[model samples]
Target: MLTSIEVAGTAQVPATDVGFLLYKHPDRVQQFATSQGGATVFFPAASPELCRVVLHVDGVGAKVDRAEGMGRYVNVVPFAASSRLVVVLGKVFGDALAGRCATRPELVDNRWPMTLTVPSVPTGGRCSPAELFEPLGWTVQTSAQPLEPPQWGDSEFVTISLSGVHTVRDALRHLSVCLPVLAGAKHYFVDDAEVDKLQRLGDGWLDTHPRRDDIAAGYVKHVRSLTDEAVMRLAGDVTTAQPADDANAVPERRASLARHRREWVVESLARAGARSVLDAGCGEGRLLAELVTALPGAQIAGVDVAPAMVDRARERLQRWRGTSVWQSSLMYTDPRCRGFDAVVLMEVIEHIEFDRLPTAMSSVFDEMAPRTVVITTPNHDHNEAYGLAGQWRHPDHRFEFTRADFAQWCASVAEEYRYRVTIDGVGEPVEGLGAPTQCAVFTRDDSSPQLNSSEGGRR
Candidate 1:
C-alpha cells in the first residue's frame, strides 16, 4: 500500500518520502506517523473504519510529550454508534519502558501488562481518568480491571502523576475544593472534619500508612492537584447531607452506586413539573423508573451512545413500554429525535467534548425546541472556595463550570436560542466548596429572535 510519513529533516524519516513498499509479513505496517519538527508527521488513515492506527515517539520526553498531548498529537478518537473494535498503536522507540505510555484506565495505576508505548492522549488535556471516572459512574479506583492493582503502584502510573501531587485523601479534598472554584460557582467549601465519622471514613483513609503503601503515591498526589476542587466540595456537601442511601444500600455486584445521583434527578424532575422527559445519555434508566412512577401518563425516552448502557436503560424501563431507547450519537446538528416537555442531562454533560457542546445543546434546546431543559455540570468555582489543593475529579469530564460560567453560558444560550434560563443547586454549600451543582433550567419561547440572528449570535 502507498503511504506518506512526516519526519524531521534532521531525522531518519522524511516528510515527502514517496513509496509503496512491498510487504509480505502479516504484521508489517505500511504507514508511519510522526512530527517532522516537534511532532512532524501525519499518517492519513486508509478509512475511518480501519481497526487500528499508529503514532511513534523518538525519546523519553517525547513519550510524555505525546501522552500529554494525545488530542493534539495523534488522530481524533473514533466514536461508535455500535460496539466496534479499534486499536491504537503507540509504537514507542522500542527501548522505552511501556509503563510511560498510558491509556485511560492504565494511567491511574503504576503497573500494567506492558504493551508497547503508544502516546495516547488522556481526556481533553483538562483532566485524567482518575478525576473523571468516578463522577461519571466508572469505578477506576474502587473497582477492578484485569490489570487493576490494589495500590497505585501497579499500573501506568505516569498518567495519574501528570495531574499534580498530594496524598490520596489530600488529592480528593483538593479536587472537591478546586473543581468548583475553577467553575466560578459559589458556596462550595465546608469542613466535614467536624462532622460524624461516616463522612470522614471516605475522606480519612488516605493518610493511613498501610493504606498509602504499595500504591502510586506520587501519581496519586499529582492526580489530586489537577481537579476542580469547588465542584467536589459542593457535591460532597450535598451528597453527604442527602447521603445517596440507595446506592450505598444496594448489593455490591450490581454496581448501582450511582442510584443516589439518579434518584436526585427524579426529584428534580417532579419539582420542575415535567410531564414527559428525555433522559439524554441515561445510563441504566435509574431516573426513568422514577419518572414513569411520578408521571404515569408522561412519555419517557432514553438515549445513549453506549449500547450496553442503552440495554440497561431499556431493561429498567421495560414495564413502561412507552420508554424507548436507541444507541445514537447525541452530537448531530439535528439529532432527529423529538423534543420532550423536558430534557434531563444529569451528570452526563461533563463527559462530552466542550467544542461540540454548543451544537448538541442547540439541537436539544433550539432546533427541537424543548420547553424545559435541565442540565447539571460540576461547578468549578466551588473547588476554589474550600482552599483545598488536591482532590476528587472524574477523568471523563471535558470541562466543569462555575456558577458564573454556567450563568454566562445559559445567558448566551438565552440570548442566542430564545430560552429563559434559571439556576438552582441540588444541595446547600459547604463553608467554602461553592455550590455542589449549578443546575440550569432552560425555558424557550419559539416566537423569539432565533439564535443565529445578528443580535443573538453566539459571539
Candidate 2:
C-alpha cells in the first residue's frame, strides 16, 4: 500500500515548514521494519514551492491471510489501504498525529492546502468513496482498475486522491481512524482498548460526522457490544436510564435524562436569583427554550462555536423576542458575554481538549465573571447503569469525571476564584451508581471583590 501527502506553498508561506510540524527532515530517507514487510518514508519533491512525502509499504499483501477456503490464493492487502497501512503510518507519524511539535507548536493547529493520495483503497462493497470522505471537507477523486477486462469485471480496489485544507495533525489522525473503517477489516485483535484508540484519533470531528455509526462499526470489525458502546459514546447518549425498580415504579411520569438535567440547571439558575443568563455552547437552543419559559423577564443569550448550531438556535428562539443567539468560541474572551447574572455551560467543558481546558475555564470564570456559574458533565461513576463501565459516555468528551474527581476539580476552581460551590446530581440516582450527570454550582463569595467588564474581570 502506498500513500502520500503533498503540501502546496505560496510566495509568503513555504511548504518547507511542514517538516517542523511533522518532525521529519526533508533531507533524510527513513525506513522501518514491519511484521509483514518494510515501510519507507521519503520526500520525492522537497522545495519551498511544494513538498511531497511518500510512505511506501512492501510485502504486506503476501503475508495477509485470506478467507479460510481461499487460503493463499487471493489477498487484497497489497492493492488496498487497510488497517495494516494505518499501523505503519501511525508508527511513522505518531507525534504528528497527536498534534505535538517541539519546534513549531503553533503550526500544529494551522490548516494548510494539501493533497493526500492513496494508490489503492478497498471500500468493502459497503459504501461509496464520496460517502466516507466528502462530509469531512475532502474533495475526492477515484479511479478503478481492471484485473483482466472480460474475465474479471473490475477490481474491488480504487485509487483515491483527496484534496483539502487541514492541519497535519488532523489529516494524520483522520487517516489513522478512517482506513480501517473503509477497508472493513483489522489485522489485530478487536478489544476494549480499540475504542480508546478510535476516540483518541477521531477526536474533534468523528463525533459530529454524519457517518459516525458506520465508521465505528467497521473500525471495530462489527463486534456488536463494542459497536453499540462506540456508537452511543459518539452520540453522547450512551444509555437511556430506566427505572431502578420496574415493578414498583410508575411509568407515566418518567422523562428523558436530558430533560431532567436541563430542569436541574433551570431550577438552579432560578434559585440563584439570576436576572440575566448566558448559555455557553448552547447547542440548538434546547436549554435556551426552557430558560426562556422558566425566566420570562430574564435577559437570556446563547453562544456556540458552530455557525449551523447558532443558526438553528436563532430559528428556535426567533419567536422569543429580546433573546439572542450568536456564534462564538468559549476558548477566548468576549466582551459581549459580560454582565450576566449567571452563565450555564451545561455539558460543555468536557468537549474541550484537556490542554485547552484551562484557557476555557479562565475565559468563563475569570473573564466573564458572572455572579453564578453552573456547569454539568457526564459522571463516569454511573457508566455501569449504561453498561459502559470503564468507558466514556461520549467519544468527543476529553474526560469524564467520577464524583470524587469532579468534587476535587470543583474545589480547586472554587478556591482559586473565591467562589462558594455546591455539587449535586441531575438524573435519578441508582444506589451506588449515582446520577448519570454531575452538576456544580459556583457562587461568588460575598466578601470577594467584583471587577467590572472595563477591568477585564479578575484576569
In order, candidate lDDTs are 0.44, 0.80
The whole-model C-alpha lDDT of candidate 1 against the native structure comes to: 0.44
Clashing pairs in 2: none
Give the alpha carbon lDDT tens digit for every residue of 42-83 in model 1. 334332222112233222222221222246446222210000
Top-TM-score structure, candidate number: 2
Write down the TM-score for model 2. 0.51
Write the residue-wise lDDT of candidate 2 on 69-101 in tens digits: 145666556546878788777777878988899
- Work out how many backbone clashes candidate 2 has: 0
